[model samples]
Target chain A: MNDPNFQNDDLLDIHNLKTYFFTREGVVRAVDGVDFKVKVGEIFGLVGESGCGKSVTSLSILRLVNPPGRVVDGSILFQGRNLLELTDAEMRQVRGNRISMIFQQPLPSLDPIRPIGDQIVEALLVHKKMDQRQAWKHAVDLLNLVGIPDASRRSHSYPFELSGGMAQRAMIAIALSCEPELLIADEPTTALDVTIQAQILELLCDLRSRLGMAIILITHDLGVVAEMADWVSVMYAGRVVEEASVNSLFEEPLHPYTRGLIESIPVLDQDRKRLNAIPGVVCDCINMPAGCKFAPRCKVQIEKNMTICNKHEPHLLEVSPNHKVRCWLYEEFSH
Target chain B: MRHTQCNDGQSNLKESTNHILVEIHNLVKYFPVRSGLFQKITAYVKAVDGVSFNIKDGETLGLVGESGCGKTTVGRSILRLTRATSGEILYDGKDILKAKSSDLKSFRRNMQIIFQDPYSSLDPRLQIGESVGLPLYVHGMKNAKQRQEIVVAMLEKVGLKAQHLNHYPYEFSGGQLQRIGIARALTLNPKFIVCDEPVSALDVSIQAQILNLLSDLQEEFGLTYLFIAHNLSVVKHFSDRVAVMYLGKIIELADRDEIYKNHLHPYTQALMSAIPHPNPHRNRQKRIILTGDVPSPLNPPAGCHFHTRCPVVMDVCNQGEPEFKEMSPGHWVACWKVS
Candidate 1:
């Protein structure tokens, strides 16, 4: 991904991306000046809990931010080309051709009445400019690629006929119909059972390797991130709290938020008496405080072990060769 | 936190009668599928078939399975939320299935349910105060003013602000809403509550909050729970004993620690393996991918329902139904190979 022909070091470089939602009350800064880069053929996991602006960032990348929710700042650069500068038509070509996105729910995304075959073919016909017959054939091939059995017969089946796992496979097939360069999967397995969820994640990894496609997987599950992500970006209250390679992030997470998230996860090996949860809920995104978003619930800060967290929002500074953390503890430790 | 130590071990060798609070015997609930204008009974979809377990008083019994595995059905049947076609549900030495209407009302006071979706489970139009106190209103406990006071007390009990009582269900976050839901179930001072995927709807950060709240509330209230969820991790945390349901039957039921440490049932093993371990250092074996989907319960496969996908399936697994038997002291399994 960081190869010489990487075309300015990133497949997707989002600089100071800001997505705000205008409600009757006030503007909710769903995503506020977040920056990260995804390289070619690499899986960049955007990790965050609910209401942390991870989904908004992905939606902004595709210019799918609807009314009331608007990208108010910064640029989204892919392969040295700015997406914001492109026309709607150009962006249309970009979507499903160069970059495709698979949403969390498959049923709502798919037209219930229409057969899945036609819908998948639409992705091909619209993006690839393929003939009807060719698109249909390609659609079936894509379905097979995602491991949907009896692709030929299953193509004609409606979304309702397919199970949740199968419908998810159809969505994946549609996403990969045009063989996009990059895929943005938003909580692809959140609703699925562990068995089916594992299968889906495995399929994503397999697809990435086979197609040499870069992926930006947005999820809260640290296990999914660790398993698939080459690089991981931990988001908390509309900010990139930490960014590191998957190995580095897991081995030595610098940010307290990242550490908390990791520790909160029920580890299989340890016989934990109680979950070490970061006490207190996530801050309401609408009325964020001036200081670090995680300051209120931080144990170290409460103990006065990390005083800087309360006064200033630390920038994501490099703590290691490939790891970056935005935390006062890291700053003090490094100093 | 309410701390009542009750062992809900499956009935087996050295069976302790004291631990058994609710015993289900050969429970079967089948929905008749009809076709044509005449509505002829074509087949029966067995949602819960030959499922049995005993829940100890003041103990959390975790029932885990994939969607449509009859786990929810098991919970609903126990509470008589859904009428079971045939089964003996022995609750504290009384058969509730044969109880009268007025007796059922008394049974309802002891048993309650906390649904999965907090948004839908709580009425949108009602205030948190009225919603939590609705049972009191139905039972005619006190006037509106007194009911409001009790609701506020319950709200504070679940870690919600008393002021938030005036707010609608839409006002609170998912976790807080679940807390309200919990508060609603607890307002009646129930002995047992069926928690069906209570924390699954919440975010990971908030899940712990609700789980901790449930644990604390259980200890405080001396409550028993038939905790059903897809998340094995949370189940491990809250449950004293765990039951793994598949298709329409309980494949395995054992102590939480024993199940996690040494799972006997093939289905349980597969489910455990499938759980993505957050720790990257502990590289578990690639999940045992169960080949094929769960067979339609309308006409479940012959013999062992899991034989279609079981990796180590035997000849007998396809010929006859595997007997649900006690494999160890408290561990109960229904597999032919687990001698």
Candidate 2:
């Protein structure tokens, strides 16, 4: 089943991807020219605030964007093939079988009436050549793999019957049924409590190592990203503002937005009373600024008298090894 | 009211009073869950069961817990926003629940609440100025010109411009809207404020701004706060003392340092450990991953509420409920193993 020609370790390569929402007010540039690579068995974090297009970028990869929103430009190269070029049927074949996704709210996403086992078995039946009996048995095994105690009995319970944590575990079981190469977990732990969130993150980490599957963990919490992701691409107003290893991202954030976000989080370990918050809010996608989306709110840009920041949007410029920042302040560092 | 963020020594120097401003004794709130053909009240969701704590004047007391843990219920009960099932809520030596209707109106003027979702809390139809000045109108402020002036001044205190008075809730960002919420709370110049997850709805960039504003307001006005939030770090950062709640009960109550560093309760330990550390290297260590979901509060475990999922559960934990006791100086815990 392995394709030798599937290129380098980049399991998913998104290049200049643009997904826009055609609303009555204006064109909402949700995921504007987003570029990133998810390597084999790598945990790639997409970090951003709400409406910054982290979810849209993920949705675009799976071709899940509705008519109101469309993946207008660029390509999603998954397994050496441009996913955008694939037919609907071909894409469907690749979807659950190769790349499965688990959402934030597990109970709502799962069918209310059907037993979780039937739901999971349905996924297996649709993706694989398995009878109901075999699929049900396999579903229980998958549930067990996802750390659900009394898998067989629990599998027969409906979504409402299970608690939030257990429902999340059930969702993970369904996601892992086909054993996809890339698992897109979009805020999988956001709806959960702290303890439950930790469990889910641990499961994600454990499953990644055991199955050697690349993961795209989309989350707003930098702490969650820091704890789990090996590398991260910080998105601001529908653009990847910076890319760096998890350590560097936390230690020395190059982008002003990234720096502000990191500093903004309430300090856990230190005795710091005051937090250094960024001024202003997230840029609007519809009535976007002429230049850098963050320029108006960019303190460093104004401090440095970088008027160019307001005139032209800065492209992703590689400064350090394996680190890239999209800002006018770091222009001198770029080649 | 139009004072700038007094970050220069004055804000840091908290002139906190030692005497309790709010004394909640054995507070309990249970929501009725109806069922069957006749829709009879078959059970009760014990949202806040046997919770007790105190908030000192001009001091921020953080109440933290997971979802449905009754932290919010506790906050609401103190202000008499939601009627408690039992227990006494003493505000400045006067019981709030026993206060007459006419007296409670004045009591509400001294006590205000700022909700979580800044978007929904403020009316979208009303102008920002009207929303801010609404409380003044209700409290028998007659002059429109005077109300306008007060609203403008209050808005300025919260880092909003005089121009923003004309704009609606939709026009402002979540942070600015939250500022409006804070400004509204301060209009009556309340002595106490219940900040219910004020920054949870805002982005990380904006959360700090709101927190800074809240702290500044607290300092400038000498306002007491009962800060209720699900995020432990936010609570730790903002509060002087903290109370950790679990399944409608205050399992642990201590100073911020003690709660963060030397947490006594097993549930508290797990909750603390569950927080994803900002540093990648640190979170890889032993995180006390508790198994199973939080049991329904409608029919909590016969013994300890947390015994169902407690990692180090003993026979006593399952047999009888442990009494909440002060094990250390100002540190209270409700676990049999801790003592």
Candidate 3:
């Protein structure tokens, strides 16, 4: 079951991770019981639509959950050690050294007043314990590695001086400066143009191959998951509804939600009047349902037979050798 | 007025004439830069410099470019949301750019616009019903009850409920707010719409719902649209014809299939090459990584605006500006090397 390429040489093993935001109305369960393992040289995709708790999950891994939100349950094991159990001091040591994350929006993520090169150097010196002279050189090298031309001169330029694409490239350089074992990229290409998006993805892919780093790519883009992910976890309302290999998930999506998402993508070849969009909006997390999270918007399921789906919550059941689904359809067939 | 694109002079032309609904002739919108205590106009940001295209009666024309490419300006200028410096905006053979207040108001009823961010577009204080019915109130169409009914109907059309009409912008999701925005634009029964990155702010799953709704609404209403966005995948699906703009000018405009299949312009080619296909197995060509940023609109290149980034840049590109000419029957491109 374990191929060298998709090895379980656990770099990051998240177990029953839950992040909930405490609001006056109710507790918004952002990421509930998401369990996944990232190997040393594999790409794991945490994909879902907006408000599906993908970004929250990434933030949780870094121990950066804000005031309203807290990690209510579960363990984040990095290199066989539990990160949740670690003190703030130890967690800081692990943050940029063991795990680094690149934000979706590069403009705001960067220091506006400071030069981008200085940002990279600061991250390097603070995390890697490098000297000022050595860190500056490393920062310029990192910028060059990210395909930024005139790296030395451009490094001196402020964040505002660089274009949108350049700012993104600079952010990538900063994220990869420490050469962390695990890199968490949250919608890295979301704000970029198509060409620039492709370039950034290619660069990430190239870096992954070169460094042999484990990556947890969080995005709403199914196409990106298809291209880069070895294993896919489709999140819906703070829970992984379906988890499978990229091929299996694409070829035969067991979860109705997964199928709807795939069908909704507008193909260049198809000359259709309208796309097969999944009707209804995503369920509000503040007032989440008791049963299956997707039960309210589910179109194909028979309401009468959806008693279990509406009343009782379903756990991830192994339907195939590797494929697992949280839907009631798999439960009846598996039994 | 109905079919002006099909010129009678061309003997090779087989398709019927009068398919064009909106024809722009040398459309230029330059924003003056005021400086100093005297407020002297030093320079101008040529936002939409000599940009032109034709939108068919019922087909959505996708206008795509980077952030500063003047795509949204073209849309605003068409609807007369922003006054153009100079150029002709022909709508049904009448110059709408020079239209009087009454005539412009009539033109506004025929053409509407949907903004990018629904939250900012909609007033948080006003309820959805009031926002949607504001156009009707402005036009003096019906009484409050009648306006409410129309708002409800429009809300239903965008896949929303009448019960939610009393809710404000903050009460709804990004997708829901966008639907409200669409409802607001359509309340006046406009024949044409400028959807300025309508679904860019929504989630991927919600994006599908909005796109599907737009397609359905377009079919039902027989509405023409100018879909402006940076997302190439959405553009490919939504538009019948696509135009690639750069530095305030269109470099390439062609039929959907033709552009995707056999792209001619360097910028269009680079843009198309950049879109990552769903299937990773298919080996894509090396991306034409354009060096340097988009040139400032205030000081564009002397000749070809794209010359700085063009992979196959020539001496002629730096010498003089290339003439925008029709390369094929339905395909038009502006490049020194094309002719």
Q: Rank candidates by TM-score, best first.
A: 2, 1, 3
- Model 1: CA > 4 A from native: A1-9, A305-308, A333-335, B1-17, B143-149
- Measured against the true two-chain complex, the DockQ scores of the candidates, in the order shown, are 0.60, 0.80, 0.55
Off by over 4 Å in 3: A1-8, A303-305, B1-19, B283-289
Better-scoring candidate (TM-score), 2 or 3 = 2
Residue-level lDDT for A40 in candidate 2: 94
Quote model 1's TM-score for chain B.
Answer: 0.93
Which has the higher TM-score value, candidate number 1 or candidate number 3? Answer: 1
Candidate 3's DockQ: 0.55
- Please tell me how candidate 1 rates in CAPRI terms: medium
lDDT per residue (tens digit) for residues B151-174 in model 2: 998999999899999999989888
lDDT of 1 by residue, B167-243 (tens): 99888888889999999998777778999999888787778778878888776666789999988887887888999
| Candidate 2: true interface contacts recovered | 0.79
Model 2: DockQ against the native?
0.80
